[model samples]
Target: MSKQVMLAASAVAVLMSCTVNAATEIQWWHAMGGSLGDKVNEIAEGYNATQDQFVVKPVFKGSYPETMTGAIAAFRAKQQPHIVQVYEVGTATMMSADKAIYPVHQLMNDSKEKFDPTAFLPSVTGYYTANSGEMLSMPFNSSTPVLYYNKSMFEKAGLSDADAPKTWNDLELVATKLLASGAQCGFTTGYQSWVQLENFAARHNVAFASNDNGFGGLDTELLVNNKAFVDHISKLEQWSKTGAFKYGGRASDAASLFYSGECAMYMNSSASYAGIKENMPNTEFGVSELPYWPSVIEQPQNSIIGGASLWVLQGHPKQDYEGVAEFFSYLSSAKVQADWHQFTGYLPITQDAFELTESQNFYQENPGTRIAIEQMTAVTPTKNSKGLRLGNFVQIRDVVDEELEQVWSGKQSAQQALDAVTARSNELLKNFERVNSKS
Candidate 1:
């Protein structure tokens, strides 16, 4: 070969190698598992395919609490991922990690990404926004609790699918009918603290904590031990005694009870739709708005969200952040967000995404898919109905679960259990406040 031809070939090889080495890998740690984990992988793959500058690597880091704990430890060791998915309850904790996080709003601004905070749903973004009106994290997989019922079980119980419970009183009646019809368990729930307590309070337009559910300041305290909460818990305890209501353990563990046809009705995150559908493909189920208490309010208030958000962590290079911003922009596109919302039952964080899904007739094709959106946007959110932003909320949820379990097991009365929960959770809040107050 001629020397000039050889030199051209060698230069071509060098350029190819430089291009391959220039692709930055962005580590993304998350808690989504099962079918949801697969979706996360697909999203990362789609973005990587669109560009060669940055490759996103998604790693499942166990459950929400576990993922958050892992990220905190990693940050302390200066080995944190570029992005970590944190549950809503951990928002306060993430916010307090001032040196460890790069606020989404700030990151977008610094990276010069065209972002409009107003593009997101107010009800969804309210949970992750700062007092200064900046978005702290990218809202992903936002979901409100909804009622899921076994259609066949309802028919066997002589209940019409159209008559799905609308109020707490109605729920009790339905549970009784299901139990009387020889159903193994009439109703069950997952994320007891989230669906039952936090959302319960929000739906009733009652306070979950003082200082506007911890959104106003860090000096907030729990107020879930009110008369309404006590009454609701007491009713559930009574149902537990009659076998009308079964305690399904914690998290989404009880989802098995509903999908397996053991329970006639289940109350869990709207995002559980994907898992429920995948697990029970042969069974027909119906989704409805979460029941509310008529005695507490003339009409039910809006429900709050319960899924995790994508938080950008600090310690990444400037170029890495540019890639992160671009990836985020792609993730927020109407097509991408709409596809995700339809597939996973998560709320389309952006209004355009929701509109895109609607325009596609996805909700009409899939019955009950829009129940969560309707529930969340039923009414203008009041301070009480917006969402919680308490410190140490994750640990507080554990306290709530523990105390509520006492009530479920007949070890403590509803009032006593709630009182204990309030006291213990307040201590956690105080500690979080002491540590993060100056930040």
Candidate 2:
């Protein structure tokens, strides 16, 4: 052979040798950002360090809505990742995309891992499970809405930190007093419609929709116009106009207010702990349960899960699916989960991690960290209290937002806003039902 031909042959041999034990890469698309995003990368790195047969790569695609849109587009284009992290509201949309997923239950069983859905808090697992008790998506960064307060603000406003509100009446008193005491702002919240409607319904043990908030069937309709809901919204409207409550736009806008000491209290996801820890390192904060209405049927039940889950996408090669499954297995480990829970404020889905945290006294030392776990496991879930899984829920939430804005802006009564939301959300549900029907 000539010199050039020999060199080409040598290069080919080098390339072949380099491919000797290379593992298949499993892509995981997620919607986590900031500190939680970094924690995700850390977990992925730990998993990759554990094995040579699988490499898990996490890609950030923006907020929850944008990520879902991208995933649907990618699915249609036949370029879906091996794994995608979808928010809780996307459950119905994902469940209906039957051909696009490899269910997590099957993956765990096939991988022969000691996967036990029963070990998870039912309030968390039930959100993503099929009727047959198989969970479609693995609960990853599950969070519940919690009442966060500024400790110094409380003391400055002449409130005892030991005596925060336990019910709606108590909150009204506290908020009224905080306002009267001339705090910059008494209370503020993010995701007005979500915390006030969806989670608020769950915390108050009411149905935001028929068919147990759409977990039962596709024919579900929004019933957020219930008396309890209207009352809650009306009260919030009064508080807003009275300067007792400041309305931040949508989706976690109030977190900044609390972190910046502009608002005395904030209602946002528990997952904000990592960011709060960084931004307000010296800021003293308290975590408490979302207060419930005193006239409600009962005390607060478990609040619904927030954050997102790691879902296995279909149409990938077996090797890639196996790699994805193995990566999930690593995530599900008790030690990894406990560490993640410690690093991030997300509830550990597995009982082992919860117990480990208890044994380590993480909660005892952290003070308010146990509130979420306690709230999640406090009651046996009734139909209304379990969680929501409505189809086209993201669009339905948009409907809730628009009508709610009308209520907040005094363009409509609370009842009128909710009635409009119910009508519009049902239309989306009907569309979902039609599309998912098998003819």
Candidate 3:
């Protein structure tokens, strides 16, 4: 070959290498596993395909608590990811560690990204915002507890498939019939503490903790031993004896029971919709708002969010942060949010996404798809329903689960179990406040 031709090819190869090296890489560590992890990777791939200047990489870092703890350790070692996904319970911990986080509002402003906080749904952003209304993190995959029932099972039970139980009384009657009709279990639930206690009290407009469920201050104490809470648990204990209500462990175990047709009715996060469809394609199901108690005078209040959000970490390069900002902007688009909501059974985080879905008649085509959105937006969120901001909440939930199991085992009454839970959880609350207040 001629020397001139060789020189031209060498220059072209060097330019290609520079172009590939110039693209910034932004790492995002999250706790999503299995199919949800695939969705996270798909989102990142879409963003990478859309832009040449930045590439977002997603890494699963175990469960939610472990992921948050890992990020903390990484931060101390000066090896943190550009962003980390923290669950709702970790909101207080993240808010307190202001030094380790670069708040979302400031990140967007500093990077000159187009971020309009008002575009997001009020209930979603409220949980991760400052007292001054500044957004702390980007809201993603926000979900609320809802009722899911097998329509075919309902038909066999001689119940109306189109009608869902609006109150606990109705649920009891239906559960009795469902079990008597050869179903293995009448009803079961995931997230026992979340569905039975936290959201239950919120829907009744009752406080789960002092200081507006810990949003007002860090010195909040749990109020799960109150009459309303105890009475609810006591009723569940009674139902357990009659085979009407079944405790299927914590977190998505009941989902398996329901999807396998072992249980006729199930209560779980709205996000479970995707899994139910993917895992049980043959089973027809209906989704509805969570049941309330008809006797309660102030019933039907809003339910709290249950999923996680994206938090920006400190010490990343300006270029990496700009990539993070750009990726966030892409994720926040209405089209992306709508597709995500439809595909994952999670509530859309923005008003535009919700409206876009509505405009496309997606809900009409897919029956029961709108129930979660309707349930969440049924009423403006009260102080009790805004969402819990408790510290060390993952451990507190474990304590609650243990005490609740005692009630089911008949070792203790509902009131007795709840009393123990409140006492134990308060100790954790006190310790958290003591340490965090000083920090």
Candidate 4:
């Protein structure tokens, strides 16, 4: 009895091991944390359950910059993951290191996956595409900035939650009322550079950088001190002095401020919707289009994306590439993308996915959830509004953040701070251009 039982159990164990060994494992290094990280793992689990040939292994590698840096170190050591999630700010850096990446379009084509760039939203994909119209990476979790306000705070200020401020003048009036009503802060924002500078310029149809925001050529220079941009910064400085605007830390630190009811209004990535809902279960909030300046002739131009994308790294096995292509195909499906967009509040990248979400009446039921998607594609993206592709943008953003803080702290004027930011960032860009030229 013991011998037969042992033999049968060993046979089953051997079969299980063989099945595990039969599937190709693809490593995906990502920066998603919290609820978003759960969603990433869920998608991987679903893909694994759907197929016997391939399994996607999603690894959380800290923040965006850290993940990209980790991947570079790994790539040099020939131990990189098959896929890496890179934030929009790192696009130029990734593009410059083309030799280290497997261009996603070529990867899909070589693996015989059906890929149609035209099927994706132009504004969403244009940021990651090459001059030849080749998509270098898969558009994943793409998001745009939107205004989030507390419904209760609006009510407390004798304002209607249903009527959100649409223009900067309207916002100024609202912020005054909010402060008068004893709110801790009238408004706050996350990703100061992205929301206040980059998207701010794009939404005003102004240039944040030269050379079409750096897409036209690598010889781009910073224009953060432009009149339109400086005006916005100056307004923020005034609001900060008035106790109407608070400076939360960079990169979504302000999200918690809104969620915790300290800040009455917030401007942040559309992807923050899920986190807001999850973390502030008791708070009643509303989402709306980002406010515009009424004095600007180009009042309502579109906003650019903020989240990250998946880039395929080089030096992976052929089978791994094939698996990566298959996983990408799964991700690109209408249903999957729609589900992701709905779950995460990121804009649906593909037209089909957006249509699917609409057909389901998700936006109608949710209310205000579609504003980010609308804002991202509201108008044709002019050269100035397409997106920023400045090299060393990650470092540039840090400079902007540091300089802007000086303005917030009242140590420097808005013009002085922005002028300093532009000068320092251009130096970094020049260094980037020179280094890349040699490589």
Candidate-wise lDDT, in order: 0.91, 0.83, 0.88, 0.89
Clashes of 3: 0
Residue pairs that clash (backbone atoms under 3 angstroms), model 4: none
User: What is the C-alpha lDDT profile of model 3 across 234-309, one tens digit per residue?
Assistant: 9999999988888888778877788788888899998888788888898888888899997874459888888999
- Taking all chains together, the TM-score of candidate 3 against the true structure is 0.93
Per-candidate TM equals: 0.92, 0.92, 0.93, 0.93
Encode model 2's per-residue lDDT on 1-439: one tens digit a residue.
6999999998897466448747677888999888778988999989988977777878999998888889889999999988888998898888888888889999888867667788887888878887667899999888888888888778877888776878878887887777777777777877776688888888878888888788778888888888999998999888878776787777776677888887787887787766676779998888888888878856677788877887788888776777777787788888999999988888998889899989999998888888988988888877777778888888887888788877778899998988898888888999989998662
Q: Write the per-residue lDDT of candidate 4 for residues 14-44, one digit (tens) a residue.
A: 5785586787778999999988899999999
In candidate 3, stretches whose alpha carbon ends up further than 4 angstroms from where it belongs are 1-21
lDDT of 1 by residue, 103-212 (tens): 99999999999999999888898889886789999998899999999988889889897779998888888988888888989899999998999999899899999999
Candidate 3: what lDDT? 0.88
Q: Is candidate 2 or candidate 3 better by TM-score?
A: 3
Better of 1 and 3 by lDDT: 1
